[model samples]
Target chain A: MIRSAAGLPARAVEPVANLWFTWRYVENNLGDITTALSQHVTLTVQAVVLALVVALPLAVLAHRRPRLAGPVLGASGVLYTVPALALFAMIYPLLWDPRTTVLIGLVMYALLVLVRNVLVGLQGVDRGVVDAARGTGIGPTRLLLTVELPLAIPSIFAGLRLATVSTVALVTIGIIVGYGGLGQLLYRGFNSQYRAEIATATVLTLLVALVADLLLMALGRALTPWARGGR
Target chain B: MRDDDVLGAAIRWLNDPLVWQGPGGVLARTVEHLGMAGAAVLLAAAVALPLGVWLGHQGRGGAWLIPLTNTSLALPTLALLMIFASSGLGFGNRPTIIALAVFAAPPILANAWTAVREVDRSVREAARGMGMSSARSLARVELPLALPLVAAGLRTAAVQVVASVSLAAFVGGGGLGRFLVDGFGTRRYGQVLAAAVLIALLCVLVEAVLALGQRLLTPVPLRTGRGAVARS
Candidate 1:
């Protein structure tokens, strides 16, 4: 009676079967999974690097001319308000390319933080220090490079770290438009109701994000030794 | 369809009286979207604000935890939604709320922590000198000063949540997302365009209201004279 009330046998339990099945899937499709993982990472890197290239100069300009700061930050803040999927829909028709849509969306999403941080970093330099540098005959360019930029490294890196991790997360939504990455794995897994597949893909995607974040943190530490123990 | 055709259709959809009523109507969808997003933000604030303030007041635990919270943004909402969906938790509201609430927590938590932590030491000392207890000092002095940032944090979280509720459509949920998801599914470009416009407008409205709140919360001194220029 108790056995009957328990219903299905232990072998029929969902979780164990799902685990075993996932193990088999991983064993059989290791190469494809790796490719997906790499694709996701590549997409994240491309977007973040592109955003940095554009945002850094813009940030410096804003920092130099305080009048521009409000407008620049406002524009990026407006861009940030647009939802990822909505942006994907708007861009897909115009660009007609999944990768381009995803890349552009990621870059736009990244701008607010990257620009804000760079500006903040630059402005954070002491006015006294700037005056001192001027007093010592440092040129405008030299002063920026020697004092301001170095001091800004930690904040700039903080922004980079944020942009990278968020880009990793947002890349998943691009699966709808055929920018296959670990997100594709997730989509397929959910569609097939394969517990193993869904679990593995989610974990793998999160791991990729975690690894990327840790790497950036380490890179920041290595680059900004002066900012180290001060924190 | 051409751009003009899409715009025309969307305008028609917007004007249609039929679209304004019923369970699947625009009004219903907006309410639903607000319900889910509002609940998520409220829940997140409930947990994040008090804890963040406490830690900020104590000046402990936040050094590491805040950064960790920030990193939680890396966790995909869709992945979280799916995991919860598959756990027999059913689809739509619950999973979406859970995912959004998690996404919403970080900004509020981080900002609140910063606001509380940065409250002037002299202010706290003054409160103590007035014979206030630690809790009293924190409640009266630290928290009031932290209000502007805390409000700003709430604004950020609310806007993000509003935008993200559209993801609920992906998992058989209700919201303005239905227009996007259902339209895309049916190749109804007009609906998709219309939905996207509505979401953007909604974000703008939320931001404007909250910006006013933040401005009002700013201390009187910070709004005028030298303090204003310093902040700017």
Candidate 2:
């Protein structure tokens, strides 16, 4: 007989297939599952938004100064190299809340991609576009806003999409801090050798990543009607 | 809580003579970690290298695979390890290696595929004009030129495997993750930090070696600012 969480004996005879997925377990655990999912989405959104806020000014500054670009890109590469678990472990002792620690780690991981993409996109603004704007008596600020930034939107969106999906996947690593969202289920499932939890958690994490990527793609499409027409 | 005290405790843990001995020592764990990570990367390269190269030489169909591979680069490491280890594969290294190898393959495959295709058209034309067979042209002419990117992809895969091998601890596989899992389980925060430090250093070491290798692989002509500059 298998023991339940309450230490009661469960029926010894059960269908082997039931171990793979059980609708009853999910139906009863809706509250925990939903809570995990919401926390995951919340964590991913906050991290990406914060990363963009930080990456934007730095990207612009680097784009303006070629000398600064190398160091900026180099630093991001190093940051990205810091593995998720190691990053979390290093940060865990310094921070009080698990969520905040994870948030900081996720932001640092994303900074490299976001800054690199933004810099590339901005630099790619056709030199003729800037020259034409200047010839029409546009100020530098107006030139950047009207001509350069809009053109960079496609590349910027690409970075955001990547960052969002990766963060969704990486959020699972935050289980060390008890904040790994659906990763809680995965970890627990492993401890108990519960097939349904492991399978469901894995499938759900993929779904979350896929859904986030699709949403970002739709947002990008809506933002850039011109990208579609040009192709 | 005093952060300095935790740091001090971690320093103590790092220097402990006992922690450096026996089946569970830091040095042993590091070696285990490196061995497993290396195996995973090599395994991935074996499968991905041929497929990626073949698809790249074909030149048309595998365009779709790039995005698919990039997405797979974020394969949920923790979850996959658990699933594999539990799937009648028996506990420990077998399952962990399979999962880690799967995680490591995409970057290599994508890189090999893209690098082959990116070799200049004129270079291929020259190889053709020399009466080189398709196999010979791909082997002798295209691959050497594509070495820089292949090296880059290998470096990415290797570093990534080193970085994530700590997860093997979760599956009863002995490695540096042993320290992490044990420390966290026992609430020994200092040990956890010490393990983190060890892992980060390992990552840095792997990255340095790969960077040197990539430089050596890159021909003098292709060394023209592609890697150093952050251009798209």
Candidate 3:
């Protein structure tokens, strides 16, 4: 029996087992586990969408005015250099909301990859293609939408793939600030010295990452079939 | 602490080698971080370079490997660190080193593979026609051509590992990250600022050194073209 600090009877620690026991434990608490998984996905999806909305226009603006691109990209790189925990702590005082910390960190991560990729993708469009579009007397808006964007989609998707992977990895850090996810399970397992729980969480996180990676690869292939063989 | 006091203390510490003392002392700490970084680079080179060479030579496996490497490159080091550390792994410098080595591998591998594969096929064929063995041709013809791009990739990986290793301080595997963590805990803003400054300076210095190395290593005059310009 494990004794309480106040001098009660001692209590026995739980026995360890193999993978099957771990699986059974997890299965018993599947509801909590699924909720945690969904929370992780929700956080990642929300952050990526929010980041694209902000970064896309910024990329276009920077492209139109080439001089601005350096400063914009530089600023984002600086933000990228700031450690995730520091970023959360830095904003904590201003926002005073723990719930948004992961969101904010994810957005910051997205900016570095997404903005640069978008700019590169846009700039990388064949000059001949753009010139021909202009020669055809297409409006600037029409050319940008039809020709420039379609060509740039490959680069944009590359950035999205990167951003998605990063977001999933970072969402794990949200566990520190009391947000729920696999990180929560990992953290709990660490504190409790529960090897089973730790392994379960870790494997689950890797699976999430692998699944996200495969999905993005498929999407990338679909969108940029031409680039498949070229690269 | 007042800004003036903090600045004065920092200036004093800069002149004080005592603050840097440890096993190898200040010099040791410096060497240790360098050694750790160097080991990681060496390990990454060993794993990534060969894999890259094979992928570059074969060119079939890249469909899976390229994206996999890219995804790995973007993985969050801190989260990974925590996961590994918490597994009763008995964390310290070794685990941190391993984690960082893994962190640094993908960029070097990806770049090396791409660079090797990208070498003009004609160059390889010509070398082979001269009765060079496949191995000899790879070493003399392909690797020489691939060196510049692979160097660039290594440079990027170096910077990344340096930054990521600083997080190891959180696991009680001391480095300059010790100063950053200590500063945060004790509210010593000056220490935090100094550590940040040192890290930034180190990154810049490493980049410059790698750039210089690239210049020295490449056999061909650096090309001034869109590809070179884009990479820079």
Candidate 4:
């Protein structure tokens, strides 16, 4: 009976056979998957790094000028609250170029967390520490680098962690515009009705997030040994 | 018939009923969206809070839960919605609830867990030394102290759920997301902007309510610059 089932006409078996075939195809295309993942990582990292570069200064500027913090942070929060897909859609026209969309979207999302964290981290620096730094004759540049940065590490790390997680997750939205990422796999899996592909991509994305979280936690621990020492 | 014509056409498109109808339709949709989000939050709290408290009080192997929650928090809500929709599950409210529930769970779980764990150790010790039963001490002491943090988590989850439930409209689930999705398909910029603006307003409103609730529930002493502090 089993043999006869396998021996049945090709059309009779194509659905079940194709399912396995698609699974194998995905397995064999591991290189494509890796490339997709690398693209995702690059997009998330570059966007986050650029956002930090921009946000850190803006945060400092706002800190120095308290009135600006409200508008700057509020605007970034509004941008952050825009749904990932909607944000991508809204920006698509101005760009009119697919290649730039991923960068644009990622950077926008990064600004949401990076800007908030920069402000929070900066503000969180103990007031006494800033006064002490000033009393020590440190200039603004040296003060930010030496005292503010170190003291703000905990909040900064928290923001980076939140930003990293958000970036990794939302980079999948890039697939909507033909940008490569794990989201592409997820989209394709759904569009093609391939359950195995969907499960595999979902699981793999979760693993990537887990790994990233662990790595960040480790970095946080290393940077703030006091936190780990239960102080 | 150059730039002004284009601009006029755009403004006219924005005024069209198809573009502007959802907000007027919001009263009906907001009920559905709120119902879904509210139920998910309630469900998540019921399950996650107790487990978090137990794990925290046990003080053994609780570290594992935090990472697990953090990892789960990273799951992309939209992708999950798409994947679930394609499984022939019949796209609509049910799938939206499940996705939003899953999205909201991690924050609730992590916050509850952290809040319980962070309760002043001296307080716990004093309770225990006074011959209080484990369950009693947890109910009377740890839970009260943890309420503010847990509330903070709920607030985060609420904001996330509100934003995420909008994605349900993408798959024909019919909420505020419907307006945004329709706006996208038709390129009605005003409708899209209006939908987005409304969603943001909804988020802020919900956040404000939750903040107020948090303030009310917290004891006055804890409410003052201490309890409900934003998590680092």
Candidate 5:
């Protein structure tokens, strides 16, 4: 078997190199990592934020009309079931730019998870609480805003957490489309047989996901103080 | 670039008899994709089912297990696949299977764990009152009740593995994804479109089959209960 520079067999030519040594290579490519990380973060944040915007109205509509919930969820579920790599490839030709395709694909994937969570959160509000408020003549808009919305924050944040972590991971796959955060390193490193670069990229990508997850968890906790102990 | 042009070309490519008759044909690639994905799901189920069930029955370890599994969602499958491929695993099917198995395990584990744990404690107690041992109670009462959720987890893992295995082509593994890679490399837009369609159809099929299986596996009583309605 041909061996890579790291003395690893090059049978697949895509193996991860040694970690300590990979650190040196990673240091040398800090600038590239930074660029990719920024791009990755930008795409992830943008897709998720956009998904939240689009999903909220849909979720509200579904919540208001219980029957609409099934079709709304089913449509998003169909999108979610589409293979990520295939979806990106299918949309790539139409969009021309990898970034746009990645953005669209990520947004589509997030919609189902986010919308479902929002619906769950809204539906989870106790009927007794709603009835009590109604008995006091609380207006619909005020009730939805001050009571229901706050109650739903926890579930919505849970969805955000799930969406963010998965999106970060998915962004790495975007390397196939010519865009990825640390994913660029994995692909380039694979082609060049640089195991260290692959290791560095993989580690950083994981770290980014970890951090995003933790941040969202904290945000969820802060947003729903009542749920802190329960969580 | 027109939509109709791409659609027409893809349909033509898919219908061409020559595309299904050879070693690298769509038939072969579809089987390859199924084999790789199926192996991963099988592997994940093997590890996750027993562990999740045991933990759930014991009512222990969930505090840590759930979080750990949740955190694993952040691990990139491609990165994991590459690492396995480069580590002298000879890439393609072996390493790809291993990585895909790892990718597919979390959902099954988490779902199964939750499913068994969520089985009605009253049901378990009633079984025990009838002189059933702990193991017997779990097997007779809990397992039956938990089967639906366990099946749901299996369905989740199966769909995920099938969809993600497209990357196997990039890593020296045989699969329908090869068409996408090869097509993109050679600028054969038809092949790319065809591959995308096949992968999507494959995922949808797996989902439908599993949904049926889940429905069938559920106990009749459970199937008609509030729990089933809530889950659906």
Candidate 6:
């Protein structure tokens, strides 16, 4: 449309304008593309990190106090039931900041996924291992530090991977607020009926999610060198 | 400090009769939302169910389920909706439903596959011992045993679909999300909040109903076995 407005296409306008995948669009909008991508990555990472921060202590508490697990998870479940779009809109009244609204919503949404997984990971450490550690004159803190935390790393990584990817997808809803990252570009494409922009942004979002998940999996392996190919 | 806080104003907006009775009333918008979500889930079920059931029966597709789920979870529904709308499918209900269906498929497929597979192996052998055909055993025994989990999957899909149907409004398709988009555009945050509350309640209602359905779908004997220890 900008090119058409620039009189770049006069005769073959329809074909050129309607093309869904052109290198020209990518080249012309490289800055915008990179900004959206970086913003998307930033929002996703921030949300997951915040969620992990909140989830870890709660998950530990829940793991330690079994009774708390039900309530913690139940609360997160209720929060999760609130849809992403609605959550963003709901947060706007109080915060009045678009990025914060998206951030808060992403954190709230990822909380359940992270908390549940982390709790499972911590609880999943074999009781025999803990008992054995205790029997070998290891202190409570030592048992947890040496055995439980290491064992739980895989599940925590799984949670982190899921939260990051889902948060990446949810960050697009930030478009409603004014900071939806690549979501903004996708929305712009939708509004202007620009297939190239839509397809490009969509593929980029998926790629980002894919890369994040893969990196987490690799990190999980690096951390848990003891875990070869099982679980 | 004031009755004009978001919650108070949202309540006031919800109390307005005008918001409840028009061509664009809450009732109509809600029905439209359900219609779109229902269609998407059903469409997804149609495709995913049989494939999951077959895969589970054969017990070979477990390798791909996690990857499939991770990929599906990463697919942005809004992007998919936009792509479908822009790629000659045009905007509105068709594109929205198709896009939402893409979101609904993974949970249903994973659940269906796991549900059927989780049926006890010895139970299957007993069915075969009774001379029941493979198909007959699956239909009568395995499927019934799997009903609870299958329904759980449907419940997840239903809630997800209903929650996401609000995206329809972004594409000019009619749904409760219209209120959110319009309200946001007009800076009517109260109405937006009210509509969101309504949608969240709808999700909870759907979840509860399907949860009940799952329990009902479970065979009476199996339900008893799992929980009610009748060991006298």
iRMSD, per candidate, in listed order: 1.4, 1.2, 4.2, 2.8, 1.1, 0.9
Docking class of 6: medium
Question: Any residue pairs clashing in model 5, and if so which?
Answer: A14-B86, A15-B86, A15-B87
Q: Which stretches of candidate 3 lie over 4 Å from their true place?
A: A1-14, A17-21, A24-39, A70-102, A126-138, A173-181, A210-231, B1-31, B54-64, B74-89, B182-197, B225-232
lDDT of 6 by residue, A150-212 (tens): 999988898888888899999998887778999999999989888899989999999999899
Instruction: Quote the positional error of residue B156 for candidate 1 in Å.
Output: 2.1
Q: Taking the tens digit of each residue's C-alpha lDDT, what string does model 1 give over A161-213?
A: 88888888899888757685888877777777777777888888888888888
Per-residue accuracy of model 3 over B32-123 as CA lDDT, tens digit each: 66777788788888898888888897757776666667667445575466556764566767778788888888888888888988889898
lDDT of 3 by residue, A1-231 (tens): 567998977666566453313667687768877887888888888888899999989999999999999889877755665556445444433444567877887788887889999999999999999999999999988988888878998888878877887778777666535673777776666556566676677667777877876787788778776677864
Q: Compared with the true structure, what per-residue lDDT tens digits does model 4 show for residues A166-211? A: 7888887765456748878877776677766666677767777767
lDDT of 2 at A19: 82
> Could you tell me the TM-score of candidate 4?
0.78
Give residue A28's lDDT in candidate 5 (0 to 100). 84
* Candidate 5 wrong stretches, greater than 4 Å: A1-21, A132-138, A225-228, B1-4, B225-232
Best of the candidates, DockQ: 6
Using alpha carbons, what is the TM-score of model 3? 0.77
Candidate 4 per-residue lDDT over residues B84-134, each given as its tens digit: 787667777777777777777777878888888899999999999999999
Fnat across every predicted model, in order? 0.56, 0.64, 0.11, 0.31, 0.75, 0.75
The Cα local distance difference test for each model comes to 0.82, 0.85, 0.72, 0.74, 0.84, 0.85
Which stretches of candidate 4 lie above 4 Å from their native place?
A: A1-23, A27-39, A63-80, A93-102, A119-138, A145-158, A175-180, A203-231, B1-24, B87-89, B125-132, B225-228
Worst 10 residues of 2 chain B by lDDT: B223-232
Which tens-of-lDDT digit does each residue in B45-148 have in candidate 6?
99989988888888785768756866888989899888888877877999999998988888888888888898899999999999999999999989988877
**Would you give me the overall lDDT of model 4?**
0.74
RMSD of each: 5.0, 3.4, 5.2, 5.0, 5.3, 4.3
lDDT for model 2, on a 0 to 1 scale?
A: 0.85
